[model samples]
Target: MIIMKAKIILILGIILSTALSSCVSIMTRTETDVHTISERDTIFSYEQKNAPGNQDMGIVYPSSRTFKSERRLYQRDSIVERKYPDFIRLGVFESVGLIGTVSGESSYGTGMFGIFPDFINLKSDYSGDSGKLFSGGIYRIGVGEWRLRWFRDAANWTIGTSMIEFLIPSAKKQNTLSSIFPLYIRKRYYLREEIPYIALVPSLGIGWYPSQYVNLSGSIDIGSLGGLNLRAYAGFAAGLNSQEAYQVRMSNESDKSHTSVFPYFGLGISFLDFVNIVPETYKEWKDHEHSSWNIGLIQASLIAAGADSSAVAQNSETKLFTGFIFKIANASVALPILNNQLYLGTSLANFVVLGFGEWGIGILPFRVGYWQTIIADELSTEPFIEYNYYPSNFLHIGNRVNLRISDFLNLGLVMGFASGETSMGIGSDITSQYGAPISFSRAYFGISVGVSDRIFFPDELRYNR
Candidate 1:
């Protein structure tokens, strides 16, 4: 629920920024080229400029009779009078470009924190295992303000940090023995990863300015994530001097990149200037930087020759495999392939959610063929896999749906039976499939809180939203 709130906030910020940017771009565009008036002499009204100043300006004016243009007049009787614009025009996106933006933030005080009790099931039988998800650890807090940046352009950077502490719901710790010595420890999942930590993020990116405040920013950020990233931090200020303009700032920094392609939405400031740096002026109103959210899905999957979640006994006689559930949270990475049609992604699924809490997250890095439409229609097959984390082996089959909503938001609902299995020697301390034997997994569901689509414009076609 907390993560969902943060997503809502960031999405809103992106929306606000896009809207404001579009307004500024249109408001600032030089609607009519000063063919008749030079910038140097533009100080006075075009009709009022004296001949000497116009002559000194050395700018040439097009002959009104020679230039071709649509007469703005609503054709009435023979005579014509141009119609005045009802309102300014705002730019819209055509194809897709990138934008980059940066921000600085600071919280007022210690910040907002809260807690709630919940239920957790670690065993296959949900009834017997359902326990206090947080017998005592139920605690959450919104840390200090964090600085953020949106990388859309070629040269964009962002840096932000927030101090946060997580009281991971405490559950009954498994005990060794009472006869030998009273000993109990927290579950490996909640213990190893839970701690009072600080979120750190810094990134660099560059994108094309499709419009003032509308940048299709493509950024690569490396940062820490903690306590549902506080929704957002925003500011509004006004400036009229040459150095400033009335501006509003919005920013975002998600360490987890939803799609390897376009995954970040940063800021939107309105009522300012417009320029493309390159093709500085296309001299076309059609070159609009679409400032809208795309709610779409990423239909893709992965096949890996890797160690499964199940471990193999090096002795051959018996495998004293470590009993830990592979985390499926951060095992997949969004690969925005060509036409934004293909995505190269990997997500780990566990048949059983054990003490270690079925650890996993999406991962990137795939062959170009995996991303390209090498396979037609995506086959519409149910793709699935089972990992033996111990020996580092996997038996994968079928096809899976990459149901993504926002550009980075995805919900992986996998339902299928595995048809094959392969094994590999485990390299100690692997991020996945470390020391467990492969478990045959049936239909499984992985819930994700980050972006997941190659194209960020799904909302245009899919959502009632």
Candidate 2:
């Protein structure tokens, strides 16, 4: 009986030991689980605290840490607030081919031709000059603006400053050698989101220098897909100054009154407007993976004009013009069109040199074209000069093919037609008694080299996983 009681005591001891060990194990596991839950909660709370401000600021974060099920939720919560750009800066240079009419005139008649004529010579009834209308090319620049917009997709309204200078053929005989400064307001509207190549821009301003005038103008931009565009410009101006502004002379000395009115139209290449539909940073779409942007640091071209039978015979020789485009700040876009990848960009530069004698300094702001890669970063060719116009009326329409030597260097062969009226001896004169100054076109072949690089954006950066 005593041995049986001892056995019972041993069984009771075993049961108690087992129950105590289980309680210790359960306590340890509970502490560990609480610690893990606390860490997770801390991380989540921190993210929540920063997420609101980041969304408001349009700060995009990587989604690698997010689970698939939470993606939709995260995206909805992180929607960025849309805001308009703070300021929009504009720089454009234009060459105006104009015709003018003088109201109530004398021996020179009531017409004017060629940019800004020698009003004094015309009034004095100079001999060997029977032209009634003065027609010529004028230079203009638009710089600086205060811009307003409600959102990224909204239209832009701007108030800006502009300057216009009339090119007097005979500076010695002309009094209108000064520039007119104007304060203007403009409106620009985008026609479509998918196609940013078309737009309508209109402006109005009052200017004073050689004369006081109120001006109204508008332009339609077309086919700017690759940095080069065709611009149709029209404008009218009414002079506000007195008759003495133009020094008009009549049959009698007492009839010293003049009315100046100018209405003009021009068709030329312009690089004033460029909008990118496919930003380089947008890589979310599989098709956009190859899209890129670049800037050309230096560019050179060889141009030939007057290749046609009529132009060559009239000019007496085929003319060749060589130029270098330097200090370029441009915008480039890559697109897939016609089963090929095409790259286009604006060729805006600060200076240009044409041939040895003729060069333009200060804000040479227009050129656009496209090239196709023939051998993936090794060779590329552009078959046409969509539209390339530099300062003082150097227009180039041609084809170019390039061979890449390194990441930042390229050599190219160019051939095409060019047109310009220059007295610098680069080409023969094609001027006429009745037409505007220095108008000529010819065919050419040229070689070029440039330094360029692809532009990178913030979204291209990667986060460590």
What CA RMSD would you report for each candidate?
23.7, 28.8
After superposition, candidate 2 runs with Cα above 4 Å error: 1-91, 99-134, 142-146, 149-155, 162-181, 189-200, 208-212, 239-260, 272-298, 301-336, 342-465
- Leading candidate by lDDT: 2
Candidate 2 lDDT over residue span 1-465, tens digit each: 434654694475345334423332321212111112111121231122234333433677554344222222221223333222222333344444443422233212212212223323433334223444434334554434455444573556766664454432221123222245566677766575444346677878666665566668787756444333465667776653344544322212324433345565555443332233323213222222223334444455544322223221234444443443343434455544543334455554433333333333323334445655576646667654434332245565566677777645567776766555433222111122112233545455667665442332213212100
Question: Where is model 1 poorest over a 10-residue stretch in terms of lDDT?
Answer: 174-183
TM-scores for every candidate against the unseen true structure: 0.24, 0.40
lDDT of each: 0.23, 0.43
User: Whole-model lDDT for model 2 versus the true structure?
Assistant: 0.43
Model 2 C-alpha RMSD vs. true structure (Å) is: 28.8
Per-residue lDDT for 12-118 in model 1, tens only? 64564455434433233344422232222122222333344334336776533332333332322333322221211111110111111111121011111111111
Candidate 1 structure lDDT: 0.23
Error of 2 at 48 (Å): 41
Total clashing pairs for each candidate = 90, 20
